[model samples]
Target chain A: MSASPHAAGSTETRQVYLFATCVIDLFAPQAGVDVVEVLERLGVTVHFPAAQTCCGQPAYTTGFPEEARKVAAAQLDLFPEPWPVIVPSGSCGGMLKQHWPRLFADDPARRVQAESIAARTVEFTDYLVNTLGFRLDAPAASGAPLRVALHTSCSARREMGTLGCGRALLERLPGVERVEHGHEAECCGFGGTFSVKHPEISAAMAADKLDALTASGCESFVSADCGCLLNLNLSLEKRGAALRGQHIASLVRARMDGAAS
Target chain B: MSAASLPQADARVSPEDFKQRSHESLHDAHLRQSFRGAMDFLVERRALQFPDLQAFNTLRKLGENVRQHALAQLPDLLERLEARLTELGVAVHWAETPADANRIFLDIARRHAATLMVKGKSMVSEEIGLNHEMAAHGVECIETDMGEYILQLDGDRPSHIIMPAIHKTKEDVAAIFHEHIDGAPLSDDVNELIAIGRRALREKFASAKIGVSGVNFMVAETGTLALVENEGNGRLCTSVPDVHVAITGLEKVVDRLEHVLPLYALLPKSATGQAVTTYLNLITGPRRAGEKDGPREMHLILLDNGRTQAYREARFRATLQCIRCGACMNHCPVYTRVGGLSYGTTYPGPIGAIISPHLMGLQSTRDLPTASSLCGACGDVCPVGIPIPDMLMKLREAGRHSVAESITPPAQALVGQGSVRRAGEVLAWRAWRVLYSHAALYRLFAWLAPRLRWLTPAWQGGWTASRAALKPAPRSLREQLARRRAGRTVPGR
Candidate 1:
């Protein structure tokens, strides 16, 4: 999954497929829009394949492999071009990059296709910091500094190993203070179906994560994965807490705009 | 003492009530705080031990490779171990079930006419209900390990594997000792409590006819049963008694003595964050001709129970590589918050979740697999790289699909396969697959979801309990992207 950033940027036709994950599709479309705007600004042609739907992570992680395979099979041929497939959510990106090969291992025809596509799959923040080398020229504001807490999803941290990529992106901003919170590496407990399956346990985890982020005295938070954003932000809203999480795509896009202005 | 006269546990906890148990455990602030602190301490100690990430990864890989190599030749190694032990005058018994192992123990006790048995901390003993079995047969089995001894006195089951009484504070332990032991003082002092347990267990160790223990590594080449512990109770259990019996899972055997070194190197560090345990007793056999301080008779029971079931599956074979290090639980987010007691199984935490379904079957342990969030913390810290999350996912699949629907053959299917397969859940997933697989259907639904966001339910079972209700955006990403392609300004922008 690691291609040289210079090689990525120097490509004559630097076009990529945007796998705007299902969560970002229905709930956080602004994140998808922000990602598109940022990539266009970086001179990368972002193609949103209409055929792409779900990544089948929900079914796969929920133990319905057969169902997951069917759903994953749909998107196999959507990225026919030999271009990088950039996913906004690490969870969905991981399902494509890591699990897709295994999901189609039994089928010889799909196995080759899965592996080929998997090599091109990259998380959004990873593509930004590594491939594009896009960083903020200055802080988001010359006024009061933006105190932000970055929440890295477990999938992003362990599976994708893109926590550093997101952290680097945010830390580069002169005015964006990336505050460290308690159990920074721990999960936010928004494990797709896990949130609904064991609600109490999931709620407890979200509460702790929210409290830690709030306790860090950050004005807002950012996460690479929208699932964690939805889980943490909604939980904070439910608690009537002022702290909330934004997708890294939206946060980075705003920072880039601020620098440009 | 008749078999009927033995006291039973006050409450026989079952994994069937995992949801309820976890709910209650989550609500207990004291229990939550206790486990959080304990786990944090253990996690920190482990981090300190493995200061160099590169070295830790290399050693962890070596440990995993050794176990994997052992597992590949498990049958041959086990046979060799049995032969070696037999030659060394150590009675080696193969048990296919928990009952078979307990029965063999009973037969040995009956042969010796034993009324008392002293035991070191043995998870296999717990797995087989060894103490209750011995007590039922008029043989009193005393737990010599301070933590287990405290739990035994309180009539409580072990929550954590290594730290059995970790759920209890020093004060709770002191109270239990004061109430159970005759003329014992109620003191929360750690040394005093340990002394009280030792003073009580010393008499039992001296008088007991049989000693019971769990082997850490059964070295096939050397015919040695390597037992690791901190308090020296394992050495005392095997040496002080006339007859010593050590039981372990069939998967514990390694091909050589050298193989145990790497595993042993990783075991204590991964388990209790110690460089090495206090005692590493390598029992070759019974007392030699000149030896005066060893058991006269030695027995080793290799219990299969449900391990063979797990070993049959290639993916699940990794589950057997576990050294019972308990590192997975210490770093697990779910285990740290909920505590081990919530599992309601003999072995709790990440290891328990993956292995319990095999032992107890998917029907009873269906909830255990799903309890975790598939967080990779357990897998990251597993001493042998068991890939616990993958194993849990496998179990979840095994438990959810019917025999015919499952890829696994009927004969090779997990016990109680499809036990937790609810018609509603299956239907829901099927519908999800249908909708998501079709591009037009998915887009339509995606568009409709946000457009009708107001119609979204206020209540969504457990999802809305601690979080606001999930509402879709005003427009779908696909719709917005389509508009952008058509050179139109997006409404939100």
Candidate 2:
């Protein structure tokens, strides 16, 4: 697996900024911890900038550009070391890489700073598969067989173009089988404020997604974004169903630990 | 045809009722299934046609460029189109508003004393409330397209742009036909239902004094109106009557006949997954001297209806590039679940969300832009490469802010600017900006939230409605990181 095309030869010890997205920071801190564990085990030093608050996706996507710009500007100085900024969630990483430059389009100084930061920003799964060559096979892959559906967030699919990174990482795990679900490319209806603004429609979409994943007969699911995991896990919990989703970071970390044990 | 057959009162489907309508639609299992099935089918068919991703992207780029070029020289091209059409003996009318469009239709109907006017499927006509206006003035406008004819008979608005009656199952259509049309029997067979509709529309076409249709593209160089349809009704409506009135949004004009080919190629494939539609009527003039069959007189109505307002800003000008393929809706997860009628507008789904704000004003369509999950499906599948999600975000900003507050104010404010901007929501965002932009404040808040997790509320506004309440984790990631960096193992891990 380490010799695969997705594997990187540059796994020499390197320091990188860890941007535990606000969603994972507050509600799913274990996922954040797992992200750190996964990175560190792969011969990388994870630096968590305490001042990092958010990637400003909620404000930006909710149509508050001024607020979003100000919030995004706050984090521009955090990753000044020229090291790669690893964001576990593709949604937040996309905000940094794709939208931050647009948000600061009129301000040349901030735009340059934003572009520099964006150039170094990479989603956790992409960094693992593409940069770190962290594929699991043989000894690492020997574990209790787990079946899971992979839900790629819209940002991962469309913005950052890391749609295949999660699947690639999982596919290399010999004991794991990725179950395909209906409308696999569709959204999970956790579009930040969109869920609250249009609850009925959002819930309806979430319900359909849940049905599709359940029908796939996967024991659980994994996604690279916390927003989607929160939406799906909570909905599953509400329905008193055992089918739930975990962040890809947490899933990978657990799989590694299980193999070691 | 009886005037009573037309829908009464032109109350533009108000987005104010969007929440309620969507609630009803979400609860309607049949409607949900119908939309899901139909959208899935359309999406699969379109995917089958575009096997090579690179080829599809290249064609999409070309389609986008053609539309953008046409719009860049829109004023010049429109004038040239009018000049060429006038030389061909086709009357050209420019309408800046829906009222202006209706007035032109009424005047033309009166000139021809057109009591019976047969229409091809025209979303523009729906936008201008043409059917109601014509009926009010004692003119019967019969929808000749099968899907539209079904909707018209049920006094129901179109739910989908390409497939108007998509929300209705075959049984529903059978019931509609059985009750509405005299001597019509109930039948769920697709061919039988289409035959029944064609039979009814044929008689209407024969007696109609005027024919009305929508243009897919208008070529300025050759003075041609391009119409694409699966049904032959668009051709019939343009040629069978003594007079033809073709209406289209002003944005449809292209510089030449060649420019129309790329857009034409993408339209039907993106629309119904067809390599080519059954009828492609290119009307250069009313009729030539030796023409066997065509309308004697032709009138082309160029409708603005808020399109000029959209064109004023480069950010939203992409809205005009839409070829009305309805591919956006077909690929949208939100549209698939909620169905089109939930939008409460002439157009529905992703395209409708962006364009309705311009067409009907932000006040009436403020909620429309927020209807999507920003899934990016619409933008991906768009034949002409309309950046629909970005346009929606722009519309959202326009709806929530005043002209002075806009990051880059347009030359003129959009219609109903700041219509949805409430003081409470404004204050909430302001507070959010405060908490997020200040690292110290955000850090303090993040620390306190998990510590005070016990005090979290059980019922979050809409969050707890269908999902379990989201509670703060025992410790935030920052706290864990701090402890780890301090050379102390985190308590939990």
Q: What is the TM-score of each candidate against the true structure?
A: 0.96, 0.97
Q: After superposition, how far is residue B415 of candidate 2 from its true place, in Å?
A: 0.8
lDDT of 2 by residue, A1-261 (tens): 222323445535588999888998999998899898877767678888889888888888887899899899999988889899999988999999999999999999999999998999999999988887776755445568888899999999999899889899888666788999998998999999999998878888888899999999998788999999899899999999988788887778777766421
Model 1 CAPRI rating: medium
- Give the RMSD in angstroms, all C-alphas superposed, for model 1: 3.0
Question: Which candidate wins on TM-score?
Answer: 2
Off by over 4 Å in 1: A1-13, A139-144, A259-261, B1-11, B408-411, B488-493
Worst 10 residues of 1 chain B by lDDT: B1-10
Question: Which ten contiguous residues of candidate 2 chain A have the minimum total lDDT?
Answer: A1-10
Leading candidate by DockQ: 2
Error of 1 at B306 (Å): 0.8
**Candidate 1: clashing pairs of residues:** none
Give lDDT tens digits, candidate 1, residues B387-428.
898888888888898778875444577888888999999999
Native contacts present in each candidate (fraction): 0.82, 0.85
What is the TM-score of chain A, computed separately for every candidate? Answer: 0.93, 0.94
